[model samples]
Target: MEAKLDLPFDADKMLAGLQRWVECESPTHDAEAVNRMMAMAGRHLALMGATVETIPGRMGFGDCVRARFPHESREKGILVLAHLDTVHPVGTLAQGLPFKRVGDKAYGPGIQDMKGGTYLAVEAIGQLIKAGIPTSKPVTVLLTSDEEVGSPSTRDLIQAEAARHSVVLVPEPARPDGGVVTGRYAIARFNLRTTGRPSHAGARLGEGRSAIREMCKQIIAIEEMTTEACTFSVGLIHGGQWVNCVATHCDAEALSMAKRQEDLDAAVERMLSLKPTGNEVHLQVTRGVTRPVWEPDDKVLALHAQAEALAKRLGFALPHESSGGGSDGNFTGAMGIPTLDGLGIQGALAHTLQEHVQISSMVPRAKLFAGLLQNV
Candidate 1:
């Protein structure tokens, strides 16, 4: 670990940026709202002498922005990944009101989920500029538009971008009480549908095959395919038109987490092989969504330890928690790059009307992030 990661950084400017982001609304899969928020943040970044680029993401309404700060020293490279799209819908602007500061907290729709965290990246970068910290690697801020919806169009881009960097630092919101997510589960969602012949239960109960019955058997098999550390759940189940009619089609969603690639493949294969009621049932498995689980490589673990030491040096104890949730860090970690996550301010109630951030905590978190970027 380097001592520079514990240095002081500008706090006031960071808070202002966070405040500005809170005032803007960026919803998932809605490119316009995301673009609007990105533009606002880009203006300030431009004034800092950083070059900016924009790419239209796969989501019709989403935009991805990258702000590059050239490095003065010779080194590999660093990437900061954040999401521009939030979980809120388009109408959240009028629904929850503009961001308002309440004592030490900032309240709004997107504040805690991501917009506030996204601003932290720029805030920290700004502080690094003010401090005259000279990093060896060029810094790139990669903000994508489709994260909240599983990065359908941006996952490949994220992985490709990760290939160009030696390290990745993510500023997703910190865990409540200021801890970061250390290990993340890699996740993939599957939509499984079963097709069967339908029959009227009361009039001709034996005339048709029951898809619902087969689906129930498959779900039971799927549930049995789990261990403790990793498991599978049949989350969504739908079948039948009415109680009187045997269902001709059944649909369900399955979620699974893996510790490694082998676990993932085995799990998927097992789920897809389920046999219903000892009868052959036509099954279709389509991906619903996918997310990277935090399985940081040796580099990531080392960087996390370094951050812990840095926090102690800066007079705070920033412990980390193992997470079952997924994030962009998952993609980077899987690429074998050292990565750190949850560098944003500590808050709770993300993705809800209650989403809010500890307004006063922004200063210290930004300073810490700036310090980490300078040395990492």
Candidate 2:
């Protein structure tokens, strides 16, 4: 085996790499886009001297890429959680490229939301190779397809791998002040459906119980169940075949956030308990906790401490923080593993057209990650 040690990553090289990633538009739920990005990333990883494996495609164009700096044994491991899927649409890049670089800020669709974080992971590992430090633990960079939409299929894979590792690091972009996120709030998405008999407008209006009305009542009930401490939104609503006739059915999907499982269950219970009048209404709730809250557990804190020390070594401050945004780290943390987030290079206005990364953050953040991998 040949060991190469010229891992010094130049920011320019990283920039070019990022441009390639950014140029390969990947939307949150678009499977084909994700496949393209994975293919590109896989090739890059192979060139970096990693033994790469392309996880079978999930559903549509969705796929995951796993790469490891090959070692003799699977003794112990550290998993790096990253997502190649962005919030941008499939034609977003070509529609306008959105790629603008000024001074040190580079703006693009997935720049800050994630592609930047993914870039950091690659750059960091490259540094380790350059630094000539055999990885502390065999490292696996698990980049998935639909992180923005939640890892419905990949969650299991992430957790299973996380359970086997000593530490899990998530590059979920940085905080506003460029601090890495230490804690993550849990996310629960739900749907409510109501059914009522439709009747003629003026002829049998009273005979037909309005499902739409029942749905409204349920929506109000769900809304009242929320508080400042808890974030909830009944974002989608649909019903009514015709305005003249009574609505035979209604449905709404909502997003909820919680600090604990109890909080999540309580919210679900409330929605389920909602009883609609006018028509004997049926309320069905489909709830899923994509990423449960990772409230800084002791082991998690220790990991953060190591991360902070590593940042200090690189002349940067690792601001201790947590975020409401959900990531696969939450999945790892929920499984009782020490998970650390926000190791990515840049952060700001994520998931938007204004999304961008601080070009200056590239090298230092990579070094910070390398420090954690080598010394921690």
- Alpha-carbon TM-score of each model against the true structure: 0.82, 0.88
Q: Which candidate should be chosen as best, given TM-score against the real structure?
A: 2
- Which segments of model 2 are wrong by more than 4 Å? 1-7, 59-61, 94-97, 196-217, 238-249, 280-282
TM-score of 1: 0.82
For 268-310, candidate 2 gives per-residue lDDT tens digits of 6665566655436666777754567788888888888877876
Q: Which 10 consecutive positions of candidate 1 have the poorest summed lDDT? A: 1-10
Across 252-352, the per-residue lDDT of candidate 1 in tens digits comes to 98989876656776777776666556454577777666675556556777788878876777777788766765788888876778888888877878877
Pairs that clash in candidate 1: 31-61, 31-62, 184-293, 184-294, 185-293, 185-294, 186-293
Against the true structure, candidate 1 has what lDDT? 0.76
Q: Top model by lDDT, which number?
A: 2
